[model samples]
Each structure stands twice: as C-alpha cells, then as structure tokens.
Target chain A: MPKSEFSRRKFLGFAGTASGLVVIAGCNKDEVVSPGTLDGVDLGSGDIGILNYAYALEQLEAAFYTQVIMTQFSGISSPEATLLTDIRDHEVAHREFFKTALGDKAIQDLEVDFSSIDFSSRDSVLATAKAFEDLGVSAYNGAGRLIETADYLVLAGKIVSVEARHAALIRDLISPGSFADDTVINSDGLDGSRKPSEVLMIAQPYIKTVINGANLPTY
Target chain B: MNLSNIIDEIEKADGEAFDRVNSRRSVLRNFAGVTGKAALAALPVAFGSLFKKAYAGTRGVQDVFDVLNYALTLEYLEAEFYVQSLLAPGLLSGQLAMSIQTISKHETAHVNFLKAAITAAGGTPVDKPGFDFSGGKGSGDGPFKNAFSDLGLFLAVAQAFEDTGVRAYKGRAAELLGGEAVTTAALQIHSVEARHAAHIRYMRQQLGSGVGNLQPWITGNMSGIDSELVQPSYNGEENTMQASVEITGINGFEISAESASEAFDEPLTPEQVLAIVDGFIV
Candidate 1:
C-alpha cells in the first residue's frame, strides 16, 4: 500500500477511538489536532494534508484574482488585463482541480483577508500576484519530497511549473527583464523553496482561517 | 575474460575508474555475492524489487548521482547556447540582450553547481558536449542556422530549449524524490527553467515574426514554431488528463480544453528529450 493510504488509515484509527476531539502527538512533540474544531481546520495528515495545503493556497489565489478582475485595477492595459484574466482562470482551474481530486477529503473554502491589498492600484495587484506565484512555486517545490504517491508528485510537478510561469510573467510586468532575477533565483541558478511551516506563517496574514499543519510531513 | 583482468584494463585506461566504481558501491553491493549464471538469470527480478524498495523510501545514491549528471549535460548545452549568442556581435542588445545575459549567467551557474554536486557524490561530471545550436547535427547548416544572426530565430530556438529543459527536469523528478536535498534542488532548478521558458515565450510573442500570439505557457501540443525538428519538444503537452482527472469542465465549470491544457505543463521522457536535443548535439 502507498504510505499515504497507510497513514490515513492510522489517523482514522486514532479518530475512531477518540471522543469529539483527537489531539495526537506530532513528530516533534507538537500537537496534531483534528479538523472541523474550534481551533480551526487541520489539513489532516499525509497526502491529503499536502493536497489541502495546496487547495488553501489556490483558494486564496483564485479569490484574489477574481476580485482583481471584478474591480479591474485602474489604468490596466488590454494586454495586462488579458494576462491577469488568464491567470485568474488558471487559478480557478487549479483550485477546482485540487477540490475535485481531494473529493470528500478536500478542506472547506478558505476565507481570505485581502484588506491590505489595494486592488485599485496596478502596482499593488501585480506585486501581490508576484508574491503569491513565487510562494506557490516554492511551496510545491518543498512539498515534493514529502509526497509518497508518484502520481501525486507528478501532478504537483505539472501544476508547479505553470505557477512558475505565472510568477515570471508577473515579475516581468513589474520590472521588465526581472523574470529570473537574483531575488528569487539564487546564486546556484536554482529557485527558492519554503517549508510548509514557513510558507503558512508568511501566508497567515492574507488568510483568515487558522490552519493546523502539525500533521503534515516534514523533510 | 576474468573480472580482475577487465578491471586492470579499465584502470589502465582511466586511473580514477576504481574510485568512481567504489563511490557507487552502495548500489552494486548486492551483486557481490551473486556470481553464477543461475543467480544472474534471477537478477532482473531482484533488481526490480531492489529499485522498488528504494523508491519506497530513500533512493540509491548512484541513482541521484546519475540524474545530476544527466541534468549537467543539458545545462552544458543551454549555457553554451547563451554564451555563444552573447558573443555574436550585434546579435542582441538593449532589454533583449540583458534578458539573455541574465539567462546565460543562470545556465552557467547551473552547470557549475551540477558539476560540483556530482563531484561531491563521488561521480565524475560528464564532459560538456559540443553543440550546433542550428539543429544541424553539427553540420552548422540546419533550418535555424541563422539563429545567432537573426533575433527572431534566436528567441524561437531559446523558447524551444527552455521549454524542453522544463519538461525534461520534471520527467526525472520522481527518481530524486527520496533524496530530500537533491529533490528540492532539482525542483528549484525545474521551476527556474519554467520561468526561463515563459520569459523566452514572452520575448517571442513580442517579436511576432512567426510566433505572434504565443502565450507565455504552452497552449496545446503546438511547438509554436511550425518546425518538425522541434516538434518533439512539445508533443504530448496537450494532455488534459492529470492523475486521471479530466481538467476540462471539471467541478461543473465551463473550462475550455485549451485553458485546461495550458494550466499544467506536461513532462517529456528522457529519451524524448534526447531525441530533440540530439539534433543540436554533435
């Protein structure tokens, strides 16, 4: 059996014996909480947890782009507008893909906190888009090693490259010829990667939901 | 011939051959006890199970080393392409030249990093292969012979190489999964290649010679170049089914097939990539 399936069964076994709440001990003595509690949503465990993590990010990206298009930042050019629209559609597609793939295991729709983002200004919107795209790419890159299923790893690979492509375009729009600049691509010619804990902490301000990623695998 | 005799002959040709073999002994350790033809006959199944076990947890050290070497070869090609392009007088200038220069630097870095990684892993880095860049198989008279002289052709070929690099790295990702540090490094490189691909595509879109209307991402399986020589790089990219999920109209949304295909980049097998790359290799 795949490691993910085996771990899911083990997690369910714990859930089965517990009362209303199940607080299992994590690898590093952290408390691994269950989902749908007052503490907020737990991303579950194993492959499902990773999928939900991706889903949550995609939700934020999709919502941000949807609002961007609805407001249509002032002075947006036709090409820029068209590109953002395409990105919005792609984000929505990615969001739906994870939801469908996860099925009953999928997490609930995430509430976004976009108050700090001024969608009216082109600079704000593009900069935020650039941050999200780079974060998404790094998140997937770091998470690849944690995935046990070959198919899921391949699927993530498929999506991450698209996210990278979106990142480059957004960066270019901000500063021409800055697509693969030193800020993201390192001295070794490799892009940066962020652990789930690091990624979620950075993403917490933009997200309203408290995500318990304690059960997610770590490298 | 006796094994000892063969080893002696190899050592004569290459002084570091034993060290190279010893570095990968972990992968060959199991073969030490099996010598008979019967044991050899059963070796295939044993090797399969061995690899399967390795895939389940940590991959073999040699596997990671080999993948790095493969990546190093491609980086050599890309680094040389950009290096030669920048050397060509009046080939590129302004923003285009700057962008190409940035990409060139990254490729050179990739080559150096991969070489260091292979050396660290006790494997000799593969020598940089000679390239034609014209798809002429070293005859220097291929269809893209004027790639350096003409800006339009340079961008087109650049697009092809970057896109191919993205797909090629992705295809080999599964092998590096269990090796955490290497997996992360390869993925980091993979996405950077995607960024390069997208930027090159944008450059091509702006040029509008034959690649006008080209999205930064691949639309379908279209190479966007109309050249059969580079078509293999884009073949199978139109795939919309990922992990058996049909991306088009999933979740009851009216998503077009083109958009669905565009949202995900497909991988090209090593053989497929090599076939496309061989045209430019001598």
Candidate 2:
C-alpha cells in the first residue's frame, strides 16, 4: 500500500525543511520569545493542565496519522488499510475536539520525532500503534481526576474509549484472536490505568515543547 | 541582548492585557468523597460502585496511603485472577496467552510500585487478600463451575471488577498528584488496566457470549433470553439506549458511559472494603 516515493525518512526531511523555512521567514518579528510561553502553550496551571496534556497527545496522534496517510506501509492489505484509515480519522477527530474544547488554552502544535520508527514495515507501524494507543489510554486515566468539569471528564472518557479501540485493533493486528486477552486484562478481566504526570514522562521524548505541568493544581 | 529592556518592551504593550487572559483552571473537589469528614469515616456509603466505607477515619498521610492501599488491593485481586486463569485447563491460545502473561507481569509491577510508593510516603501498605467473586457465600462449586461454563457470568464479574478499577484510579488520583513519580507510575498502570478491560470485552464478542461486556455500567444485551442481562442505555449494536444516571457534587457528571440499566456493581468504601476484607489474605 506504500507509495515508493514517500518514505517516512523523506517525510521527516520535508517537515524539517518546512520548519527551517518558517524560522528564517520570522526573523523580523519583535516578540519577547522567552525560553518558554509560546502563544497557546498551556502551562497547565489547573484542570486545563490535564486537558492540555491530553491535547498534546492528541496532537502527536494527528501528526503520526497524517504521516501514515502520506506514506502507507508496504505489503498492507485492503482491510488493514481501511481500518488504519478509520483509526486515523478518529484520531484526527479527537485532535480537533481537544483543540476546540481547550480553545485558546490548547497547547501549540507539537514537533514529533518518529525517526526511530520504520513505517515501511507493518510490524513496525503496528508496534508503534500499540504503544501510542496504550499510552493514550493511560494518559486519559491518569489525568481524569485533575479535570474539574464533569463535561471535560466525560469528553475524556469518550476519547479514551476510542484509544481503547485503537489498542484492540493494534493488538489484533499483531496477533488475531488476541484482543482483550489476559495481558491487557488482569485475571479479573479488568484494564489498567496510569496518572498524568507519569504519562507525560513517557510521552515527552516524542514531544518537543516544554510542558509546564509542574504547577498544575492537584487534589 | 538586554533582558530588562526586553521584559519592559513587552510589559508596556500588554501589562493590563494580561488580566483579560483566562484564569488558571480550578482544581476539582473530591467529588467521590469531599464531605471533609474523617477520611476513615467515609466508608460503606456507596458512591455508585465505590463503597464509601473504604476511606473512613484515616488521617493525612494515612488517608493518602490508604488510597494507594485500595489500588493495591484491586491490583492484587486482578493479579490473583490472572494467576488462576492462566493455570485453568483448556482456556487460552495464541495472542491470548502472550497478552495474559504480559498483563500478569504488569500487575506484578503495579503492586510492587504501589507498595514502594506507600512505604516511601511513610504509610504501611495494606496486606493482600483473596478476592471472592462468587456471589453465593455458601457454595464453592456454584461460583467456580459457573465461571467456567457460563462465560457470561465470568465476563460480567470481570466487567464489574475492571470498571471498578477504572473508577478507583479516578477516585484516588487526587492523592497521587502531589508526588510526581508516584503519580506518573500509577497513571501508567491505570491506563494499562483500561486496555485490559477493552481487550476482555473484545474477546467476549468473539466468543459470542453476548454479555454487555463493552459497557459495564450500561447494560444492553446478552445472548440468553433473560431481562436481567438486558441493559437499556447502551448505544452499541444491541441497544440505542443512553446513560441516565448522574453523579452529584460534580457538574455535568454522567455515571454510565452507556445509557442502559443492567447489572450494576456497587462501589466499595475503604471502610466497607476493610470490613469485607477483614480475614481475607492474598
């Protein structure tokens, strides 16, 4: 399913070139431009912090899926292509939802480093999907309480369930009939969850912007 | 090159403009149990599925410590379930085996991490306990055989336990927010648990057990001809229902992800948990 001309490496080079061009063009702007505090880079002082955190992850997902679409993995079948595409659309919807929900408080567009990923291979892509899906689920679980508004929490629940779907699909892709096996489910047939601070640490390397999560209010 | 000049130049243009910016979002009250009474006294008073009794009368560090202990208790129960299920005859295959093994390891890791965090926080970890999923207190075979033959029962119990775990983490997240290291690890493990629940539900779908495995709180449909299994609020394939229950204290709080009424697993308070778990050992 992959196009021969558009390798993930090639895509990165293009994105980097585009960023470089932007930097050069912005030389005349006279903003303070401190080490931190970009416009819309939510410092996460309170409940918005958790929402910002989810927003950041969603940004990463949208970026990854955009790249996936740009260069489909080689040797992928039609059903896999269709499923992956659906997942991509869902992630995009989630990304936009968070951006809209957070409005001006949403974090800026994050720069992702997926150079370590070999997207040409199905195994590599699915493995990455598994990781992202798993991380997204944990992110929501960890940040759920920090959210003050019930509407926001419910929104998170909705988004996280979508992540859970991604996790199921990725698990099955890795091995059929393995969806919801004991590994994802404990013996009691339940799932696991993590907190936001922990989830951010795992997601940080892939994200470039500084997240001011330290000052966010907690219980 | 001049820092003060840079600060002044920007400050002059928008000193008052900063006031128009939104205030930092407020931290939420502990909607689950924010009555401000003794932590230990909040027991047995059920808030949906989590029994209020679990947290009564416990003091400052102890209250936080109990939160971890409660999480540990749930993990232990889940861990034990996997340990036994893995050993059960003729029950698993392919990706299922690997997934279960990995989950076992994850649970073990969670238990260890929580134990360490609790001790580091200067509170004693709650000892592990044997979880009895059997509804009937008198008959052992009824529960065991039912778990094996009626996969539906097994999934229902599984659903309750997983859903409880998901909410348990949500309830206790406030306590961990103070410690970054502990909070990060707890959240990671919590999400893993959510994935596990989804996976289990997917498996049930494959096996055609047709329990409302996907949405635990909202029941939609079961394969059998029983009204007990028919949840009204689920929006999945079986029912176009929506969740009607709501949680007080929190604005816009919907208790069930799905809008159906099926079998609901009651919440356990820390005190009720202690009482129920008095003699149990993991």
Q: Measured against the native two-chain assembly using Cα atoms, what DockQ does each of the candidate structures obtain, in the order listed?
A: 0.36, 0.10
User: B134-163 in candidate 2: lDDT tens per residue?
Assistant: 533323433334553354555545554554
Name model 2 segments beyond 4 Å from true: A1-50, A60-93, A107-128, A134-165, A176-219, B1-59, B93-95, B141-145, B149-156, B209-282
lDDT of 1 by residue, B191-274 (tens): 999999999998887778677468889988887786777888888888888777898998887778888989999988877877
- Which stretches in model 1 have alpha-carbon errors above 4 Å? A1-38, B1-58
The 0-to-1 C-alpha lDDT of every candidate, in the order given, reads 0.76, 0.50
Query: How would the docking of model 2 be graded?
Result: incorrect
Clash totals for all candidate models: 0, 63
Worst 10 residues of 1 chain A by lDDT: A18-27
Q: Pick the candidate with the highest TM-score.
A: 1
Docking class of 1: acceptable
Local distance difference test, candidate 2: 0.50
Task: For residue B145, give model 1's deviation from the true position in Å.
Answer: 1.1
